[model samples]
Target: MTSTTDHTQQPREAEEAREGEGTTGTGPDAGSGAWDDGLIARRAAAASATAGGQPVVPLLPAPHTGTPASGPDGADDDLTARLDALRELTGLSRPRVDAATLAEAGRVLDDAAARRRLSRRHTVVALAGATGSGKSTLFNTLAGVTISDTGVRRPTTSAALACSWTDGAAGLLDRLEIPGRLRRRPVQGPDGPGPLDGLVLIDLPDHDSAAVEHRAQVDRVLAHVDAVIWVVDPEKYGDALLHERYLRPMAGHAEVTFVVLNQVDRLPEDAADQVLDDLRRLLDEDGIALGEHGEPGATVLALSALTGEGVGELRDCLGQLTSERRAAARRIGADLDAAAERLRPAYVPTGRVGLSEEAREEFADRLAEAVGAAAAGQTAERAWRRNAGRACGTPWLRLWRWYEARRTPGTAERPPGGTPGAEATAARQRVEQAVRVVADEAASGLPTPWADAVREAAARGADGLPEALDGLTAPEPAPARPPRPGWWPVAVLAQVSMTLLQVVGGIWLLGQVLGVFTPDLLPPVLLMVAGILGGPCVEYGSRLAARGPARRYGADAERALRDAAAGCGRARVLDPVAAELLRYREVREQYARVLDPVGGDGARGRAGGRHVRVTELSTTGR
Candidate 1:
């Protein structure tokens, strides 16, 4: 039997030895007892960089095994990374995520970290059960001595009792608050050396004790222990408090649990099987997986701790557990799994957040409309045409307009400029509306915390937007009028020539009418008609020639106004929204890393990094 036990344990020990060299010694408890401050800072920096979507090499240490003195590979580094990620995530999602939820996650991390840094050599297994369940008797039976008080008392054990078959468990016992008086070392079994060496078996107070403190003490020990064997009697195997309050909540921790139907010796063989089946059904209802069909799950068996029946099987199971020395790592992994499940919704959203080009273009357009960019462009175009018309019109018309303007001094038309208060108010409202539309689109499908964050970012970016936009619309100082075209002079000269011909023709006609000269009437008549028709034609042709330049001038003004509006929109709204979405994406990816260090799906402890197999520890012992 000893040879067979060693045979079973040697392969695992060899595997652990080979994998032990892979430890990089950068974890929280790496190299020595002292903490690695430099490594902690690097991890913090990496987490900070992750929040900004920056790529960083997270130089985290790998996890060490239960026997840290030997430097085994326990995948402790992944948990540290996850803890850092959680810290970073919580920092980023503050006030958005519920305080209670964050507090729970914090508690889990704190407990796991504390437990991990303590003694890894001893596998602390608690035997927890209700009052008079024979747990104290079982504790003594396993220790091969009367280490715990057990009698007619309703609540046999008030405080925990610890029994170690090996040395180096003082630190662990101290952490458990087990007094020196209650600590013991086991004597040799009938065969010789105890089968369960290196195991720190804790006899916890009755879980359902009438005394509240006893029950509370039971809970405290259960929280810290590496594994638990629930000793239940035949009558109380389906007890509501045991199944409801403890077993169901700890369903994820099946790998570290053993449900023993103690006191089964009182039942007949056939009846015992029926009772065991019923107990299995109850555990299944509590969501605890059973290791019955060669699967990795909780171990369930019949054992009469008082009669010594089936006690050997239980010892064999525990011996396998202690020999493997992975109980601490397994329990920590299960704790991490529970914490990650609670935090999943906050970190992992339905889909990713993104900002598309179409949304950007639309936002810009809206902003331009809010500022009346197109209207300004049209006004500029018309102004250019009117100015050109005045510059290129006939001299006679110019003289008439000048005389009229002098008569009505204040009636001259002004350029399209000057933003009114009412118009600015309307424009401000439009700008705000445009901002809301884009912010909503960017935040869609994100969780409440991240969506809230995106909105806050947009708000901050747009805080001074309306004022900035108001400044953009303020009329620019009138520029020096552009130099006129050389053709203006030629057109003016042609008009002047037409006026001279008309003047000379009129004088000749007058002379003929007065009978002072007998010039040919047909020549004078022809000259008069040509001068009259030619002057108007030249003015009309000039107006038409200026149309192309006037249109281009208008287009340039429109483009400038729209471009200015678009730039303001991009600065105030688009950029910030895009940035928020990017941050969410990066943080979300970091969250994925926390959930699975290998950067994929499944429970963090099971799917990623080097971790104790859930079924391997529990099922192997059975």
Candidate 2:
């Protein structure tokens, strides 16, 4: 039975072999050492020799196996473990690393974790390119099976294909939107060396001619993968559109890249070599290294799945990469870098707050102050009085009151309880107007988007106030509570007195006209008659004038307030802030996974140990 002891012993043995090979300096076995060290030394010597200097150093053989490496890949295991952790935390199947999307995602993950929003997990590798670039072919080759369809058709791949060696990895396929029908058989080598043991390979449609939707599909998947394999063919190898549009811009992702020259069999032998060389040079110019030795370069390989010429070599290279664990960690690092970049806008802490604390407080205070000034209670009472007066007071009583105000000393007229003071009504109006101005000002100076939200909110808040106020201030329709019975006594007396005075005066006037009575009595009689009719007529006209607009004005005010408040309440000030917050949370979670990993006996750890926390380490002291 396989035991923990066996797993532990394997790395020790590998380390010993590496040391031995390093000491032996002579045969094919002499070159083995730290993978990166050997690779760097060889590259340096090669460079020197190419300059026509004395042969600087001989190329060394990479250590075959057996090392105390941390991850499944011979690289950094800590980072890989963290990536896996992050993936699980985020509920995302894998970490995506690509030129177009990596930076944004990296920033988001970092900020999310810093804010304790979510966790992160494993790095996902996706193969993407134009049709006939052999992405499916390469995926099948890497997976060691004929999982994806490959044929002579112009566009062979119709949908995305996903292959993973880890058990229960089927969940990931579902997340990637890969249908079960496309799931392929796993290719197991001797000793159960499963293809893609710890890796998930996603084969996407050709980005060139597939339906626009297919291209969208490819882009969507690429956004989530941890690494990418950009497959290209000889005929279109130097296509400016491909390089300028896809390759050159991706120079930042050199570490997580594998540039494959596929369908090499189609090219003449010498021509193929020339093309490969040119490709390498171009990549170098774009700041992408060509071999595994460079610190920040992609691994380049020529392969033909049709002929199987370079298939095994590529497989072995992948196996070695997986076995080292550092590749996985690097992948996580790359993903973290990308996620951090995406979240930068939100997470970096905008030095200038959109609304300062003092400003917010000031606005709130202004709102409260305006409400106070509106004197709503006073307005309501005044409105109630006005209606009551109109409803209860008789016309005679009103005329008597008006007359008393002008002529009486202690017995001044009152509208039953009394008229509402003008000061209170004016105060109420002032408060309402103040509220409107304050609301408008508070909503101003915000970003257009935010300002719109504030305006909507303010309108909502003020929605019903106008209506409520209008209802209170609306005039009574008619005198529902007519003046008391006593009012009739005053009316009768005034009428009787006026009639007697007119009769006496009219007789005197007739006498004067007949040259019998004095002219004085005639003038008094005429004046009394005019006064009696004029008072009643003026009262009737005044009521008619005040009735119509008083009722309508209150109703209009109510409607206006209702509409404004409704609009204000509906406004959303927090949406933009909340959305940004959520985005930051998502990214921080991803970042955490890259920084810290949870180790378990899961498929994630099969390739190598998890990646080291290089980012944290680098920033730790600072």
Candidate 3:
């Protein structure tokens, strides 16, 4: 037979009973081994760690043979997978999620691990209610012993008092952070032997206590319990402080929750039923379902804690609950549900964020302009023409060479040599402008924080890009001269022919002047005129023929510089920004998968499509 009585409570109970037999010291028998209340209570509490022997103390014929320590593993495995996903998400979202939010969600995982390591043998049930609700009395009555103090003052319970049903749950209690002084064990009662074994009951201080510490203690202990029995009386049942502040918020925890109407003995049976019905309606409005596992209803029960009236029904319910021993899992499951719900806002958005192709091309053009690509192309075209003029222009005139050196202080004429530093500076300015353009485009339409990240990413390696581009442009080579035009030889020959005529005319004219025999003077003078006139036309035609090569050189230079600038922009800015975007998108997808419901099986405690800030602990405290 399985007995889950606490190992620590029996010895204390025996010691207290032993001391109570002695006469009171205040009645003139004080010196004759008489025991006072304070001394007995203290002595009972001071029992050694080993004073309580075995955990189980039989109270009746046990129907169950084995401890319920081994619970169903299917739910446990499923819940573990969910928790694993939750932990992973917590780590992944650190860049965006605040520290406090992570800390709050993080506690669910920590508590889950702690609960698993602690005793699975005992179900930690808490009796929580406002002051004057008779929760303490109910706790003592449930344990079949008067362990908690019942009072009429505003706040009777100052701290949590725990009564464990079994011996092996000491580790579990320790994990709960309950001090040993405040812990107790239940002594068996005489009414047909109450059947509550493997149950750890706690009476919590009033949540609305005026003393901050008392309320804080209650809040702290409330976070660690496996199940909660909200002990509300007739008056406080409809209290807004209890319903609105606590019950409504914990709707997802309906599985492990119980709404018990304490002090129902004061109300007639029909009246009690009506109040129970009203409480159920309120719970329904709060979104708490009515039932456990597949069972339905809020599991509402009415009993008078002080009179022991209708208390048997409460005991039987506890007996079955303790025997099942899956309350811990249910409690953790509810915690996971709430945690998942809180994280919905971060992952719920869909669609990828990226720069359009048109936007990219425009940005590249801006970068090219910033690097002086057009100016460089034009300079290349002019330089090509200058080289052509030097190589194939009329040798006799050489006017193109002379014109190239026509330098003035403020003119647009090219210097005999180009300045590298001045060109680099111009390119640098263009690069700066390009950076702003690309960053702004990439960040457009993004949320403020994401936009900032995009801009930062775009500018990540911006400093080195200009220098790289400058190095590329510095070695700019002149375009190959276009194959000389097909008519270039004819033009050159015509010029030579015209010059010969002039030479012939000059010799004849000189001879005539020197009184030597020569051609007729009229013919010589006409030949000179024609030769001079034709020379100008031939030179003009040659310049015209050079235009094709000049334009080609300009286009080639523009292409090269544009390619270099584009490469610079891609390497330094666009690639990094794209990477950041992809990262954000990937994280969003991972979050979606993590939060997605598993096979539509809501049984695993997933809260679909709910979002809320986790600034405060859930109404469940943890």
What are the Cα lDDT values of the candidates?
Answer: 0.70, 0.49, 0.64
- Candidate 3 collision pairs: 4-165, 5-165, 6-165, 9-185, 25-30, 290-297, 290-298, 291-297, 370-430
Q: Which residue window of length 10 is worst by lDDT in model 2? A: 15-24
Each prediction's TM-score versus the true structure: 0.80, 0.40, 0.66
Residue 480 lDDT in model 3?
63
Candidate 2 lands at a TM-score of 0.40
Q: Model 1 clash tally? A: 4
Best by lDDT: 1
> What RMSD value applies to candidate 1?
8.2
Output the lDDT of residue 537, model 3: 71
**Per-prediction CA RMSD (Å):** 8.2, 21.7, 17.5
lDDT by residue (tens digit), candidate 2, 444-477 = 4332333344445544545454444334434557
Which wins on TM-score, candidate 2 or candidate 3? 3
Cα distance off (Å), candidate 3, residue 23? 55
lDDT string for model 3 (583-613, tens) is 4443443343333323233343433222121
Off by over 4 Å in 1: 1-77, 91-99, 189-195, 412-419, 483-552, 600-622
User: TM-score: which candidate is best?
Assistant: 1
